[model samples]
Target: MEMLSGAEMVVRALQDEGVEYIFGYPGGAVLHIYDALFQQDTVNHILVRHEQAATHAADGYARSTGKPGVVLVTSGPGATNAITGIATAFMDSIPMVVLSGQVRSDWIGDDAFQETDMVGLSRPIVKHSFMVRDPRQIPEMIKKAFYIANTGRPGPVLVDIPKDHTAPHNTFPYEYPKKVKMRSYAPVTRGHSGQIRKAVDELLKAKRPVLYAGGGVVQGEASQALTALARKLNFPVTNTLMGLGAYPGSDEQFLGMLGMHGTYEANMAMHNADVILVAGARLDDRVTNDARKFCPGAKIIHIDIDPASISKNVAAHIPIVGPVKQVLEEMLTMLDEQGEVGTDTKSLERWWQEIAGWRKVHGLRYETNEQGPMKPQQVVQALYKATKGEAYVTSDVGQHQMFAAQHYLYDRPRQWINSGGLGTMGFGLPAAMGVQFAHPDAVVACVTGEGSIQMNIQELSTCLQYGLPIKIININNQALGMVRQWQDMQYGGRHSQSYMESLPDFVKLAESYGHVGMLVEKLEDLDGAMEEAFALKDRLVFMDIYVDPTEHVYPMHIADGSMRDMWLSKTERT
Candidate 1:
């Protein structure tokens, strides 16, 4: 046994868990932990401007790498600032462990300086939260936090360490736990044989079949399994906004993303599907506008690790509760046993033809003027071309997020990272920082709107300090793009306060932060600007692209209408 202070135990435990990077912002209450971090070199700490960015950065790291992201912060405001990012992770089910310093145990009720009830504040969002009651329990608690964050349906887990818990005097013999077990928590990893059989039977009988995938496919690392199953059955695959790249976008079987901002072909396929196989996707409002109208005639075979998510939104006719990768693998094995007896070939052919007809709607089409203001969609398309579809793309929530999802045809999982469930605007830039850190040699880009970029713009300093050469693609609509789009459609064209009245000079702002900045107001200058930016391989580059302010994301669905009802372009907004 090795004698160590509580702070030392924290560092040792993280290293044992194979943690290589941590995102954090230091404060008074967490100085001891910071000091412990300083004495170590295995775990690198990324200093962020705000506590919120730390969590978002950690989230990006987790989503991109399929590992639990770690975060360290001070008590009170530090913990509270991280709440939004934690909630964002919770909604998306990202694996993360948040370590926050707290007030001393004796001063907890006294409301001492920098004291805040972090456990209480974070209870609703985290998968589990713990307040360290004993200094010796640090190793065990840290292990449990990581276990909870990464197992079952992966999510953020918080562990609040009172400053006294890590005091220099509280020394003890420490050994990091090799394994963690909780009698109360055991997630089923294999699907019920009977349920999988039933699902296979239903699939063989499907006339109009669709394979709908969500973040779970990416989280479960089952993209290959999903692709194999879809090809075996010849079913059209449609992914959710967060589920992009689960199937190759260029594949003829892929029907594009399916949801509120999804493709017209994908939504139509969902509405008319006879057998819908939903893998790791919650049928949230964005995907299913009204539960009553979603896949009305479909016999849904839902595969999920979380049983609560199966029927919580849309009722599952044949539910297989288990790990998506395992279940999908099992399903493939069963199909393999059947040889060529699996799908109704004639029916699948008819389904594919119907999908092709729907695809002709061309919902993603956007205008590109050689000399006029740029269309935001073209920026994303150009990004895809410049990167040759190899860059790791992250996005902030808004019209640009939708455009990126629609235009940037991803061919692999974990490449398209964004705030999907919580729709957090400030997620993109900080997330790109984490993505860049994870793959230092890979090209990473943050696709964000003007409003979203400013939310965590201060992280520019962190980028400079770390030498993270991420490309920041700012689609400057000079207004809250999404808000204006909604107002224009639902509020009788009332712009209201959606437009930005006072905006900072983004070009100078980037230059001031010790990075290269380029402004592209016309289509001709766009390609040249992007080329120059990527050519600077050692420095971060910010491209401020001014686009038409009145443009709205189209293929817009009718309010309170089923997936079948969609307005292909602005001509049908009314």
Candidate 2:
């Protein structure tokens, strides 16, 4: 082994893990590591404007590529700024390794400069966290961080390295381990045969069944298996917000997204189902508004890698704790072997007819005018048509996000990436940057609202500097559209701080960053603007599409309300 500095060891460890890119913002504390990074040519470092954006970029990189995203940041405020991103990744189970530089070891607990309890601050959000007390432990810590972040239920992992540890003279020879085996960290990969049998038995006996899939299926790489199971049993599948692309949105068996702002057919299916096969999805409050009333008549079969997630919100009659892909494969194999289970074909057809009726009556309807003030749904639909549903789509949290989810049909996994769990407003721009970085040749787009776009709008410079051809679609409504919708519905339209009195001309802002910018105010201009944006292959394009200010997401279910209690629009009740 060659003698190395802690900073050098850090770089070496990253190289050993085949890390090609690192998103980070440097500071005084991480100067040595930055110097080491500067000397290295194998790993490319992306300098983000803020620490939070760095983590978000990494998260996007991970989610799109199915590889663990790496992030580097300084201590104190740097680490604190990364908390929202860390929590965002954690809540969605995205694999990320966050390396943070801490204050010197000798000054521990002395209230040193640029110091914070990184471990304590991050413990709750991170899958695992470590404070590197010794420089020799750097290799092991880095390995553990990556392993924990990517294995089992993928999530963010933080490793805080003290300033003294990175000093040139304080490190020992680096020895990277070939493998890591933690006795207590084993994750179940296969479901029990007996449990699988029971789940199949339930599916065969039910008259009306629904398949609820989530991000876990995407993360577990079980989308094909999920599709096969849904098709073989002739089940209508509904994806959670995080599971948007887990099943083909265009499939006839697909019932669109479920829960608040979910499809009328999907929500109705859940409300009226007799058997619910939930795979890789946690019944979060957003999906099950009132846990007690969620699928009241359904015998839920929950399958997940994390055992604690089962029955945490909605009760599960059969719970299978295992990896989604493996469990689904076994279930499919068992079904083929068992042959027909005497399922009622006529009853299933009748259930589909009822679902079809709901779809026909209340399916994703929106109003638009060709003259002026284009609807957000129209813009999204135009973008989808322009790209032919081939681009990677990321969305900032708001009505625009819901509209994108509703309008754009994603046929493949990893094609639709967004901040679903944490609902971070500033997630889109930075995340699009990451997605573009990961797939430089692929078309990448970010759908953002007026308010959410401003949160990480500075990243446009990052895009221009890196020459990332990310299409930024700003759905300009001049208000916090989702909050305004809530206020309009719940608070008698008081409109507290939801309206933006003065908003920047996004086109001029894009031009200021030396990028192409286009504005679309009329519905007729949307397709042309989207086509121009999609045709660009060299420069980043910012398209500010002005939408109707009063537009709101529909089929909205109130807090603790039943799935059937959906409001079709502001003035229409379903």
Candidate 3:
């Protein structure tokens, strides 16, 4: 065994974990750790302008690569600033390990400078929180952090390390744990055969069935199994916001997203389905709207790795707790042995006709003028066409996020990333940077709005410094579009502080950061601008596209409203 400082142990442990990049910002409390990190050559460090952006960048890296993203930050405000990012990752079930510095062990509870209760503050949002009391426990804690963060129902894990642990005199031999064993944390990876048989029996017996999938399927890497199951049964599939790319959006069986801003046909199908097969999706309020009235005619079958999520929100007739991929594989094998007891062909045709009627009546529609300011929908459509639906898309929370969700079609898991559970603003830019870092050869784009882009706009410097070719599409409406829409619909259009009185010129802002910037005001120039942005292979591009200020997202289901109570557009009421 070799002697090493606590800081050296931390760096060595990270190297053992195969950590390639660490997104973070340093401070006085973490100076020793930072120095250790500087001496390391295997791990690359990205210094983000804000601690929040650092977490987001790590989250993006995790989402895109299906690995536990690592973050390092100082104590006090640095740790606090990262809360939003941590909460966002937790809500979305993204795997992340956040390492924050703490005051010296001797100064504990003495109101030390930059000292805050990191464990208490983060307990609510993190899957688990730990404060390192002994320097020897650092290696073990690091191992546990990664294990917990990437295991069943993956989420962010926080570890607070005291400054004293990194003292020069403090020494411990470094050795990475060969395995992690948590007595109470073993996750069930296989579904019970009896329950799988029961679910398959129900699916074969039902005539009008729907598969509602969520991000859990993506997290489990079960898209292939999910696709096989859907195709074999010839069932229509609808995804939640987080589940967009679980099923190919171009497939005829795909019914688009199914929630508050879901497609008309998707919502209608859910309301009318006789059997609802839920795969890796939680029945959140946004999807259910009214729990009592949701899918009144359906018998629900929920499959998830976490047993607590089985029937917590909505009653599940058949609840199967296991990994999505394994469960789906088992179900498919059982169905094959049973000789494919498919649903009635005539009944399915009739159901399809009915769903087709709804699609024709309430399809996604938007108005645009070729000579006027570009519509947000038009810009998104243009981007989709320009990129050929191959770019990794991230979005900041607002109407622009909804528009991106609606217009862009994702055909694979991890292609589309957004703040679904937390709806955090300013998630786009940093997330895009993370995605770009994960897939340096692939195109990455961040679709943001005027209001949300300013939250972490300083990250543009990070992009420029790293030479990351991330495309930033700002839908400039000069207002908090989503809030304004709500105010217009629910608050008598008072507008409040939603409007941006002195919005900075995005093109000029991009130029200041030494990046290419383009402005598109007219609809006719959108395609050309998008083409130009896509052609730039080396430099970052910022496209500030002007859109209709008064425009609102359609097919909106307000709180406490049923799927049938959707508002089609501004001119149409429920």
RMSD of each: 1.1, 1.1, 1.1
Which sections of candidate 1 miss by over 4 Å? 369-371
CA deviation > 4 Å runs, candidate 2: 340-342, 370-372
**What's the CA error at residue 293 for candidate 2, in Å?**
1.1
lDDT of 2 by residue, 112-230 (tens): 88899999999999999989988999999999989989988999999999998999776688899989999879878688889998998888888999999999999999999999988
Q: Candidate 3 at 137: error in angstroms?
A: 0.5
State the lDDT of candidate 3 residue by residue for 1-574, as single tens digits.
Answer: 9888999988998999999999999997888899999997998999999999999999999999999989999999999999999999999999999999999999979999999989999988999988999999989999999999999999999989999998768798878898999998898879988998899989988889999999999999999999999999888999999999999988899999998999989988998899999999999988998888888899999999989888988899999999999999998898788785576777888888888888887647987666666788888999999999989999999999999999999999999999999999999999998999999999999999999999999999999999999999999998999999999999999998899998898899999999999999888888999999989998899999989998889888867877656888877755
Candidate 3 Cα deviation (angstroms), residue 571: 3.1
TM-score for candidate 3, residues paired by index:
0.98
Error of 3 at 324 (Å): 1.1
What's the lDDT for residue 239 in model 3?
94
TM-score of 2: 0.98
TM-score of each: 0.99, 0.98, 0.98
lDDT of 1 by residue, 1-574 (tens): 8999988999999999999999999988888889999998999999999999999999999999999999999998998999999999999999999999998888998989989999999999999998999989999999999999999999999999988888877689999888888899898878999999899899899999999999999999999999998888888999999899999988999999988888889999999999999999988888887788888899999999999999998899999999999988988889888787657898888888888888887887766667667899989988988899988999999999999999999999999999999999999999999999999999999999899999999999999999999999999998899999999888998999998878888889999999988889888877888888888898899999999888889777787788877777777542
Model 1 steric clash pairs: none
User: How many residue pairs clash (N, CA or C atoms closer than 3 angstroms) in each of the candidate models, in the order given?
Assistant: 0, 0, 0
